[model samples]
Target: MSWAVLVISGVLEAVWAAALDRSEGFSRPLPSVVFGIALAGSMGGLAYAMRELPLGTSYAVWVGIGAVLAVAYAMITGAESVSVLKVLFLAMIVGGVVGLKALH
Candidate 1:
């Protein structure tokens, strides 16, 4: 359950990041609201997960998941360009996250 919540939190992290980008320095009302809500939810989930998981592992996994998703979304939406190198590094990040999951 904790792991599930942590993963959800990681996804929320990506959501908030994308929202933040869309917010344009908080000038846009809708995206700014989305950013605030997602950010809060993500942090809350992370805090809850930390109760049972190792701090370092949880944090790293959270960041790794968030980063990969953010970049992938950007590329998918054409907000960012895709390249082989970028995809390769994203795969590496996914591998590392999976490796961490396998550890425990």
Candidate 2:
């Protein structure tokens, strides 16, 4: 349950990050609301997961998942360029996240 929540939170982190970019310094109404909502949910989930998971491991996993997904989404949407090197590095991060999960 905790791991599930953590993953959801990580995905939400990406959601919030993308929304924040579209928020235009938080001046836009809809994107601003999305950002605020996702931010709260992501933080809440992280805090909840930390109750059972080790802080360092949990936080690192959360960040890795979020960063990878955010960049992937941006690339997919043409908001950012995709490259072989970029994908290779993202795969490395994915591998590390999997390794950490295997550890626990």
Q: How many Å off is the CA of 30 in candidate 1?
A: 0.6
Residue lDDT tens for model 2, 1-104: 88999999999999999999999999999999999999999999999999999998789889999999999999999999989999999999999989988999
- Give every collision pair in model 1: none
Find the 10 residues in a row with the least total lDDT in model 1: 1-10
Instruction: Give the alpha carbon lDDT tens digit for every residue of 14-41 in model 1.
Output: 9999999999999999999999999999
**What is residue 21's positional error in candidate 1, in angstroms?**
0.7
lDDT of 2 at 4: 93
Clashes counted in candidate 2 amount to 0
**lDDT, candidate 1, residue 5?**
90
| Native-to-model Cα distance after best TM-score fit, residue 41 in candidate 1, in Å | 0.4
Best by lDDT: 1
Worst lDDT run of 10 residues, candidate 2, spans 53-62
For every model shown, what is its TM-score relative to the native structure? 0.98, 0.98
